[model samples]
Target chain A: MPACPKCQGLIQETDAFCGHCGNPLAATDPDRREDVFDVLTPTLAYYFITLLLLGIYKLTSVFPEGFEGIIVITAIDVAIVIAFWGNYFQSLRPLFSLRGLSLKVMAFTIVGAMVGSVVVSVVAKWINLSIQDDVFYSTYMFQDTAYPFLFSTLFIAVQPAIFEEVAFRGFLFDNLLKVTPGKSTVYVTGFVFAIIHLNIISLLWLVPLGLALGFLRGRYNTLWYGMVAHFTYNFSLTVFEFLSWF
Target chain B: METSSVDSSAETLACENCQAVNSATQKFCSQCSFPIGGTKNEQIAFRSNIAVRTRMLKESERHVSICKKLLYFLAGINLLLGLYFGFAADDFPSMISSICVALLFLILTAWADRNPFGAILTAFIVYLTLNVVNIIDNPALLSRGIPSKIICTVLFVGGIRSARQVTLQREALEKLKAPGIGNR
Candidate 1:
């Protein structure tokens, strides 16, 4: 039976479209879109409590000065990654039973990252004239940094590719498909993905990325495809940053 | 269209308003939005979806709450450790760094409460800003680039995971309260 992408409502197998929501029922693979509220709330709550405590400490003269900010940021990043590792592996268990699919999905994620990054960079330059940022095409952040090559590669190439795909493609995309009424689910999820970046300049870059990723996931019916594409896009950025071409 | 009357017994099942023939097992009028007599099949289907979605959300929420508490505790410990190291080793930067680290984490947790995605983005921005500041200001830390890189890598990996976990739990919870599942 064909299913509605939005609400996961089943339709007749031979139906041209979903009767419940009127979405075209040509495809068999279901879309999965993650919910932002589900992903952000508890962490935000804890972060808030911690911030309050830090505020008091600063007021009382216990606040660390100079390089201490780096330490705190580093630790928070560590905590978040640990959580990602746990979830990523847990989610992967089911796919372990299907080794080929798993490999394909992983490859797909990397490719997606590369493509996304190239697209972002190109669009960034094209619209550079449209935005007003003294730091728009700076060689400073990438050039002056002692290990621009390493950090950019690691941050851009490795981390974002994996986590973003897991969050957006693996989880958000799937859940979104279950809630929406029709094909509107795809657009809604894509829009949410774009907005998540929280940068007006990034809106243009992200929306297309969202649509492309959504389409790839739906086309392949595998999370790995999105992941590979995401990875590729990011890896390319890392390389570009390394070469200082940007 | 003609107002045609159906043989009630022959059709066996029919809509009250539209009088359209339906199956004995069908629970809804295809033409008009009406209850198909007294069968509870649709009700059971509706309830099951709600129950499943609800259960998933609640389960994820509990996990998220625990993770949040854990992060807070970790921040506290890091802060205390910084104080101890500051006095013992007389390395003010190390001490400050530890305390600042705790503070940043706290900020992230707080920001996350209001906006989860914002918390992650801010965390990244904060980290990058702090590192850049340190690289410019602290010659000693700058000279120790390898160690800094290692530290960055470790934290980056860990942060991404924790961020993912927080988000996963949130997503599950949202699904629980989503529309359509519980709607009549």
Candidate 2:
């Protein structure tokens, strides 16, 4: 005797239907097919939203000047993501979990950020010289300000560190990891992060920085370390700009 | 001897379709004429056949979904380009045609999500026909139409593959719903 594939009822060897449930046992066997949509839906949703926002920013003349624009855009981005993926946020709670941060981890994050800042600065200097173009900073906005140092540091460094880390390393990277293979997840997320910036000149540096941040997020299984690194990178540049070192 | 005879008769095959009992030696049910078997080997073979067909149907559905998603992305791109060309281009006829084709692709994309085989086939035919007419009207479009033709070719092949799988799955389902077999 054979068991029915659907109702699990025992039937004669040549029987096509289940005796108990009257189900077509041969046709109703379980389908174990895996669809990528399970992963693609959220990932694509995030990217599509981001692209749509970028398009709006390009086309519209409604945005405010200077740091206000950045704040408005970041706020909108956060709001859109929260609204779009409200249900999924609960599952992503682990990525944002700050409970496990130890003294050792804190020290590592600080030291790593400092070291990464120096290395990136050196590389950026060389690239800037080779390309014969400025490092594409928005320091011009602060040039005529009452507090150039404070404003630039706040706008260029802290804002991106908090908002971008939450968006890219925290949300986008985690969602991408679900769909992508373990080895390629970091690289793919990094590429997307760099591309989203839409700066060909800064791409050379942004790509590696994105990769480093992605690596930190994956290795430590948290977003704080990447945020610290990002802040350090941007803060270091701001400090140099204030001191006129570059 | 009586107990042993009763136990032997209890081993008689039952019809899955009609629940009619038949003797162990019978090849088919007496009440419903449904097929029945006695050997363990036949039971295993039947189970394996069902498993294989089920797996094939699932795999086909997955492929169709993946292809449909790709087509949706392409359609979106086409729509954007059509909008840009429609508003900005000086060539009135070409711009209108481009917008119409893009709208058609968008409809096909939505349709593909539901009926991939039919939608893909229709898109393939429409694209091919349009390209042929354009080329006959103005041979200059040969250069411009190459990409469209290639895309249609790919869509046509994908549609054929999806259609074949859908047909196979439908046939299997029909077999399950035949006179003696119940619907799953």
Candidate 3:
């Protein structure tokens, strides 16, 4: 006896509809999803809300100018994520688990991220001869009366390390796993991560870094590994920026 | 060509329309679902359902094509606007900025041509983000290009609706393409 593809109710070989479910024997495909959007509707919706809010703030001039602005915006981001996070909590919960955490691989991830950050920055600067990144840093990053470096570490490194890993590695990567092969999942999520940052110049290095982060999450089955790696990478760059490497 | 006079008592049956064979217990033909073993009324109902679905697929495809043109128009407008600004203001960076944006739209347009549902949504998100950056960077900029901006936003919203239509149509078509699942 075969089964209905959609309802899974057993049916006789010659039956057009399942005996129990009466569903037409048509629609026998197991999974109907064909495109990236097919699998990523929910995840994209969550991402869209955040981006839309940011745009709304800019257009309205309601967003503040400095640290207060950053805090408020970050707060809204967190709230938006939390709102969406409730629905996906069950699906995303596994990413937070710490099973199979190997000390050796963790150590390598941290070291590799640190070393890779230097190469990325240097190569990025080389690729664009006049990499006027100072404008970007001055415009968006830790501005203020004092403790700019500390704020830089917090905002630039720690925040993205923890939060971004949750979004891209946690939500987006996991969503891709169902539709794509394992390695493709890493590559696709990496590409998406880089593009979302909206910096065309930074895409050269950001893409690889996104791939690295995706690899860590998928391999370890936990976001902790990726978070630590992301923090190390971003923190090293933060330190380098203060040291005037650019 | 439909031969719905399938014999219920026979061990094997052949489809009335396509002539594909099926088991007597099967109410629909295996290859074409021609109601090889069903009564006259059942066969009519099955075909009516299929006809309705086929009509929907055709409608959705038409809608997707219209939305795709909107994306192409957006790309051309961005290229023209960016070049105008770059030349008028004599700022290379500003010029590069719009050119890059134009390129992104062109790429997105191509992607939409292939996969309208997912690709168009991606474009819609990026389009909004760019405008947000523009408004934040210079509030005056929004006031400067009111008509074009409004038109672009309308196109994006329309494109998104068309993408939803594509999503629904593709799902229905997939069922027919699946093995052992002839037209519903």
Q: Which ten residues in a row have the lowest lDDT in candidate 3 chain B?
A: B175-184
CA lDDT scores, all candidates in order: 0.50, 0.61, 0.67
For each candidate, give the interface RMSD after superposing the true interface residues on Cα.
13.1, 13.3, 7.1
Best by DockQ: 3
Q: Please, what are the lDDT tens digits per residue for candidate 1 over residues A1-246?
A: 445576576544443333344343444321244444464444334333333333333333344532343235334544654564465566544422334466655665666566666666666778663221311122223444676566555554455556555555654455444433224444544555554443435556666778777776665566656656765765675566556554
Clashes of each: 69, 0, 1
Q: Rank by lDDT, highest first.
A: 3, 2, 1
Off by over 4 Å in 3: A1-22, A25-49, A52-76, A100-116, A127-152, A171-200, A207-225, A242-246, B1-10, B16-21, B29-34, B140-158, B164-168, B177-184
Model 1 root-mean-square deviation = 15.7
For candidate 2, lDDT tens digit of each residue in A76-169?
8768766644656676678778888777876777777777667666776776552124233356666677887887787778877876777677
Residue B142, candidate 3: Cα error in Å is: 5.2
lDDT of 2 by residue, B24-119 (tens): 555544333344553566545545665676677777777676666656665676666667776776665456556656665687678666556546
Supply the TM-score of chain A against the true chain A for every candidate structure: 0.55, 0.72, 0.75
Between 1 and 2, whose lDDT is larger?
Answer: 2
Error of 1 at A2 (Å): 22
Considering TM-score, where higher is better, how would the candidates rank from best to worst? 3, 2, 1
Ranking by DockQ: 3, 2, 1
Off by over 4 Å in 2: A1-34, A55-65, A84-87, A129-137, B1-184
lDDT of 3 at B166: 56
